[model samples]
Target: MSRKLLKLKGAFDLRPWYQRNDYLGWIMRAKRDATKVRRLQQMLDELRAGDAYMNMAWRPRR
Candidate 1:
């Protein structure tokens, strides 16, 4: 897998990027598990709501 880097401000922990990613990956594996659907959506929402630092973190370096 390609490395995913996350740039966090001094206010944030470095763990969330990996934790959230791992959780999302786990959710994908349970394609037919209805119990996790809501959780998956919640996580997706978190990712979408990420701040400016996160947005820049994922962008390709110029």
Candidate 2:
């Protein structure tokens, strides 16, 4: 069986095995997006914690 090599932008080309495998691309993209989502969630949690602390600190004592 003959397979065409996919030319990559940098230097190396995609091997026949990778060229034939379709899910690898989707999995890579999903993993990247998942990482981004995790980072965003952590930042959001930090911001919320800071906001709550500021609110408590600004309250006047009776």
Candidate 3:
């Protein structure tokens, strides 16, 4: 979990464990600098929004 994202009202913790784990592995697997940055940005955006994961619609646990 990102310290910055963690500061956002448990945004990282809000995600499913599988999503978090898989995203880390997927993001770290990027071979290009731009790809890593893009994936990371997408992750941050998704986490911040709390309404989507990997560009797919998602509803948080209520």
Candidate 4:
């Protein structure tokens, strides 16, 4: 489900390289499976919505 959303939006590709790495590293640092899942879900939601990043409003360049 997450992969589909990411792929559909080219989410990872569209973001700055450092942002992408930060997101993945943040998720990986989660000590609990639940936390990891929660972060991943949040990432997907932000990507699919096309309006936010890291829980903050973000409008992509046109």
* Stretches of model 2 off by over 4 angstroms after superposition: 1-31, 51-62
Strongest candidate by TM-score: 3
Candidate closest to the true structure, highest lDDT: 3
Q: Per-residue lDDT tens digits of candidate 4, residues 1-62? A: 67686584687689878778878998999999999999988887887787888998988888
Residue 46 in candidate 3, Cα distance off native in Å: 0.6
**Candidates' lDDT values, in order?**
0.49, 0.34, 0.84, 0.84
Candidate 2, residues 1-62: lDDT per residue as tens digits?
A: 22212222111222234422432443345457786566445433433343222123322124
Give the least accurate 10-residue stretch of model 4, judged by summed lDDT: 3-12
At residue 45, candidate 3 shows an lDDT of 88
Model 4 regions more than 4 Å off: 1-9
Measured against the true structure, the TM-scores of the candidates, in listed sequence, are 0.35, 0.32, 0.81, 0.80
Give the 10-residue window scoring lowest on summed lDDT in candidate 2.
4-13
What is candidate 4's TM-score against the reference?
0.80
Judged by TM-score relative to the true structure, which candidate is superior, 2 or 3? 3
lDDT at residue 27 of model 3 (Cα atoms): 94
The TM-score measured for candidate 1 stands at 0.35
